[model samples]
Each structure stands twice: as structure tokens, then as C-alpha cells.
Target: MSSASSSSVSAAAPASDWSAARIAEAAAEIVAGEQLPAIVQAGHPVLRTRAVAFDGQLDAELLDALLTIMRRTMHEAPGVGLAAPQIGLPLRLAVLEDTWAADEEIAHTRSREPLPFVAMVNPAYIPVGDGRAEFFEGCLSVRGYTAVVRRPDRVEARWSAPDGAARAAEFRGWQARIVQHETDHLGGTLYLDKAEARSLCANEEYSARWAQSTPEHAARALGF
Candidate 1:
């Protein structure tokens, strides 16, 4: 979600109701019902609400399992990141990994690179420079749509790991976008709210027309 907030945003009790053991129970129910845990889609109450801060709400066992499941879910979705709210747990937790690069040229153009899996809790970020960049982005929650969203080109990010270890790192380019996208979920923000409306398109159209190393051409054509 974007930093732009509206009156529709709500708080805990709704999405944050699941955490610790509650999350496990929810997943178990999904499995028991012969369904895999699903991504909470747009318009759901869970996606419209802010995630709760992670402050010892889960025991070590629950935390580990939750992180594992989240990572697996993200990988299975084959997405670079997955936030807690996307999976019905509105806690400040998310997993991220991006190992794909079509080729060296695209990688360098977007500053894209392989990022190992990491589970961030209560994550936050601040722009590292005045630099900004724009590119098409898609969300697992939003499903088959993509849009151009401008974001800080670099950032100083801080979050606690699943192991309770604190981390502060500098991220730039595509990785910075990934961090911001996931962190926005904790605040009940979606990239849609911040995206250039004119650039919105179905995933198919995105691939059929605007799939490029950068968004400059699309931005010009879409009048965004």
C-alpha cells in the first residue's frame, strides 16, 4: 500500500486478531478445509487494516513456524515479498527474497540482484538520498495488475529479525522498492494508492506492451 492514507483505514482487532498460536490455528483450518493458506485479496477487511506491532506476542515456536510458513508462501507465490496482512495475520512481519534477474543488462538497469530470504518484524525505512525512481510494481494481494509507482531510490531500513536480532541496512534500487512495498502493508497502505493511475493495466497488458528495462517509455505513453 502507499503512504497516502484515507478514512477507510482501520486498526487491529480486525486483521491483527491472528498471531502467535492463532495464526497456526488459522492455517490448520485452511489445510483442514482442503485449501492452502491463501493471500488476503484487496477489499478484504484484513488488507484495509493496519498490522499490529510485533512485541513478544508470539512464542519462539510460533514465531519460527510463522516465519517458515510465510517464507514458503512467498516462494510458492513466487513473489519477492509477502507481508503479514497478505496472509491474514496483521502483525508487523514479512518475508522477502528476489533471486531472479532475466540477464545482466536488466539487472544492472534496475539495480536488481539476488536477495536471500529474510523475515522482518516491525520494519521501517527512510530515504537515503534525494534520488527517486519509478517502475511498474505488482502485489500478491492485488493479484494480476501492475502499475508504475515512484519510490525512493535508496533507503536506510530497520527491522528486527525472527531471531530477535536487530538489523539496520542500506538498500537501493529494486531492493529498496521491495522493502517499501512490504513495509507499507504494516500501515495498511497499498501501492495502488500511490501508483500513477494512468499506468494501471492488467498483467497481460504489462507484459504485452510495457515490459522493458525501465518505465520511461511507458510513462511517456501512458501520460503518467
Candidate 2:
């Protein structure tokens, strides 16, 4: 089968309350068939441009469609999070998977663990606690490169949920980093902007060093 057909089949097969027919219809409207999104490459103007604020109500069909697209795109690309702009949609919204859970088998194996899906709309973050951690970062838009970026080990974020409920929540460790990274994308800032000079690396180099560095040391090395 063609890659596009294969992707369509995969996306269609996810078992969720979200209807397959609805997903297929919405996907057709927002995405171009099964083609991979034209991820805004590093130098693209849109990648650097701050997205316009989303002024409409959150519970609309469009928001639902966007959420689906974000989920599918992130899943297809295997990233922990994605911002609307990365897929050429200009909206102040992003999605992040809780990476901490993904990294630890004990966490993932727990029955009550929250699903990895999270969506933030018009979100803002406040760093909580003075501790910081550094971790290797990669972007779907800037495929094949990785960087070390430092971020607060925890943060307090406020945003409206997809259902229009206001939320204030604390996130720590890798979850904190993922939220901050995806939030920056909504604001049109790539990790490269916040990345420390020495921490930047091609994928292979990053893989080599990521295993050796302490979290704190990695954060500092990445200029976080």
C-alpha cells in the first residue's frame, strides 16, 4: 500500500469514543488526504511568527476538528506534543503528551495513569519552584535535529479546556518541558531559540550525550 493509504488506515483504526467516521470526515476537511502535514520547517516564516489568538468559543466543531488533527499529526509523527502552527494552522493552541509517564514503565503500566493526550488553548505558564532540569528536545517541524533545553522542573499553567472549563494545574519533570515547548510553538518560538549553543546537536550526537548527562547538567549545557 502507499504510505498515505497506510497512514489513513492507522489513523482510522484508533479505538476511542471519537467516531471513526467523524475523524475521517474532519481529517478530510482539515488535512489533505493521508499526506503528512507540511511541517513548518525551521526557516519558514510561519514557524517564527507568533500565532494569532483564538477568539472563538472553545466548544465548536472547528475546535474539535483542530484537536483531532493535532492528535493525529502528533501520533503520526511520534512527538510528545504539537502546536497548531507546526501543521500550518495559525491558532493559539497546542497538545502535549505526558512524557514522564512514557519514559517509566511503572508509570505507563499503571491502570489509572492519565492518558497521554492533553490540549491547551490560549494557555499561559508560570514557573513554580526554583529547580530546573535539562532534557534533550526534538521537533517534528525541525526533524533530524535535537537540542538540550533547560526549563523549570515544574510549572503552574492556566488555560481553558476544550469543554470551556478553566483550569490551573501544576506539571513537573518531562511533562513541564513538553508543555513549555509546545506552548512556545503556539507563540511561534522553536526550541532552537531557547536552546543553549553547546547543547545543539544532530540527532546522533544528541543521543550519544543525552545518556551521559545529569538532568541539571543537561539543563545548564542547553542554556535553559
Candidate 3:
């Protein structure tokens, strides 16, 4: 199977950096149409429920499979992040990547640096300071629109690496928002739950208003 057209959907910067052939390879596997794990929606019984930790060894195959499914789901839904719980997996894991970058650059020949596509396992976030920003946020599970949400501008987090090593990192700006959004999913919360009452916007309106907002503004408007 040929890789799905990188042009047809948003992808992480790393995926954008992949050569057409490389994307084709991955897309072939995806286009063959493996069963999509269930994506739990808002008001679903399990979506509001917390997920369990992944207790087994962190082997390469497991990591690859998780990443593959994540990429596929993100492509199919054209979403920025996905959680195992959203897929009905009940595991405390999620993937977050920059789909917007792919949309912006797919037509160009220049290769950009890979955005670190995160595979967080049993992740935890610790806010570093009192700084807060609002950004527009959309969810794969919620579908159809985005909402203004406020979130910390920066965060310190600890997560298990694919190789099972614990690592600590600091994130700010868009990266921070992405991490927070995916983390919320693992905890059985969606951005809709956190969005301020007046911030909700139809998908088209949010896109038109926020398509060019600064990272901070985007985060702020979304209530990140």
C-alpha cells in the first residue's frame, strides 16, 4: 500500500521531514486499513474514567506499534493528539505531534526539523510557574469544533521513555500545550471539560480567527 498523501492531512514536523518515499512506506501500511481502535467520545462512560498504567516491558515492537497506530489515528482524524483511552485501550499513554506544521509545509521542498513526536507513558506534569496563557484547543474525540482554554505557559514533566528510562523535561509554548492536552486525555479529561463557557467556537470560525495567532494567543484563546 502506498503511504497516504502527506498533503491530505496534518502531520507532525518529523513526519513532514520524511521523504515522500518514506511517507509512502508508512502510508501503505496505514492505507491497508487496519482496524482503528475505538475513539471514545465526550459523555462516553470510559472517556471520563482514568486509564491504567502499562505494566509490561517497553520493547521496540510495542513502541513501534503504538507509534504507528498513533500516526494512523492522527492522520485519519486530522488531529493534533490522541490518547490510548480515546482509542479504548485504557492505557496511560498518548501521542502528541504538530499536525498543523505538516499542513503548512507539505507543498514545499524544504525539509524541516522533526517536531519531537512524544510517546508519553504514565506521564505527569508539574507547572513551573504561575504564568498562564489561553489557546484554542480541539480534540479528536470531541470533533467538529474548538474551544478557548487557558493553560500554564510552561511546565516540567516526567515520563517513561520507550526504552523504560525515566526522563524529565521542560516545555513551553505550543509544546507545553500539546503535552497538557494529551495528559488530560490519559486522566479521562477532555479540553471541552476545561474550556471556559464562552470560549467555544465552531471549527470553521476557530480556524479562521486563529490560523495566524501567535502561539501564546492560540493557546490562550483555546483556554489552554
Candidate 4:
């Protein structure tokens, strides 16, 4: 979920409960032959639970099905990344992709770039250095909001691919942010834990007031 504060939105109930209705609705569609999967929101028990590592499930039909559903769900959310806990599954799995083709403004501000879709199982990461950067972040699970968060500027991640091949890679820029965000889900860490609470706002409010602003600008304007 987005690093946005949970207090920003005044939902009917908690976000998790309210979003469950939509998730159930999505499940109903799936039962009716729709392939899209539902996305669970923040405050869900699953999101707070640390995920289990995949054992020898690579060859299992269930794993294959889950990956398929997750990919479809990621694309349907129109988000660049997703984690299993965001879907009511406390599994250490995540998927990510970014065409890095948002309008020039966003692309440059977030350091976006093209990256092929990747599915990582039981991923882990380490900071590459003392360098840090702050950016406005968003998440599909924490819908309709964004907040400024500070994180290491780069990280090296190790994980098993969907095919069961072990791999490790260093990431930087927006790509690093995406990796950090998704992996955090596996550890039951939500972005809000690192977010500047005063910077939280609805997506619409963010777009109107801070979309053109950087994290530094937001901090100055919002007093975070």
C-alpha cells in the first residue's frame, strides 16, 4: 500500500473492511469467468502478517495459478507493482513492471525507466549506501492517496524468480523505490510506517496541490 497515512481517508469503516466488499465483488466476477483478482487494502490482517517463504511450490499448480492471478490483478490495478499480502495472501511474492512512460514530468521526477515485468519470490534487500532520497509514493492497496517517504537511494535485492532460479540484482532510482515498497509488504511493513504523516492527502488533493511538487516542496508546503 501507499506510504500515505491511514488517517487521510474517512472511509465507512476501516479501509480493509470497506475494501473487502469490493474484493468480494471482484471474486464474484472471477466466479463468473472474469479473470481479474481482487486487491485487498491496508488494515487487513493479511497485510499486517509477515508472509511465508515459498518452499518447493514452484512446480505446484497452485503456485502457477497464483502467479497468473497476481499478474492479472497487477495489470488491472494499473499499478507498477503488487505484493501477495495486498491480495489477502500472506505469501512472500511480488510482481513489478514500469514502462517509465508517464508524462515527462512524472517520469523525470520519479526517476522512472523501462523494466520488464518480474515476479520475485521470498525477496530480500539491503541498502547500497548511506545515500537517501525522498519521493511522493502511492500504492494500489492504499488507494486514492500518496505521501512523501524517505528511503535509501539504492538497494541490492536477492530472490528466486518464478521459474525457481535464484538471482540478485542492484536497483537505483524509482526502480529501487518499487523494489523496497513491494518487499516491505512481505515483512508486514506498510509504507505509512515511513511516511510523513502531514503529507498525506487524497489522490485528488495530491494531484491538485502537490502533483507538480517534489518531496522537498511538499515538506515545505505541508509542514511535514
> Clash number for every model?
4, 1, 22, 0
lDDT measured at residue 210 in model 4 versus the true structure, 0 to 100: 79
**Cα lDDT of model 3 by residue, 62-134, tens digit:** 5567667866787677666677667655556677666354444421321212336677777888787998866
| Cα displacement (Å) at residue 86, model 4 | 1.1
Those runs of model 3 whose alpha carbons end farther than 4 Å from true positions after fitting are 1-33, 57-60, 102-114, 208-224
Q: Model 4, 105-167: lDDT tens per residue?
A: 766766667768888988989889898878788888888878888988789999987778999
| Cα misplacement distance, residue 197 of candidate 4 (Å) | 0.8
Sort the candidates on lDDT, descending order.
1, 4, 2, 3
Local distance difference test, each candidate: 0.77, 0.62, 0.60, 0.72
Q: In model 1, how many backbone clashes occur?
A: 4
Candidate that beats the other on lDDT, 2 or 4, i.e. the better one: 4
Judge candidate 1 at residue 106 and give its lDDT. Answer: 60
* Collision pairs in model 2: 134-219
Which predicted model would earn the best lDDT?
1
Give lDDT: candidate 3, residue 181: 77
Residues 97-139, candidate 2: write the lDDT tens digits: 6433233442332211333677887787878879876556678
Residue-wise C-alpha lDDT for candidate 1, range 115-204, written one tens digit per residue: 778889889888887999888889988888989888898988899888889999999888888898888888788888889999999988
Q: Which candidate comes out best when scored by TM-score?
A: 1
Every model's TM-score: 0.87, 0.73, 0.70, 0.82
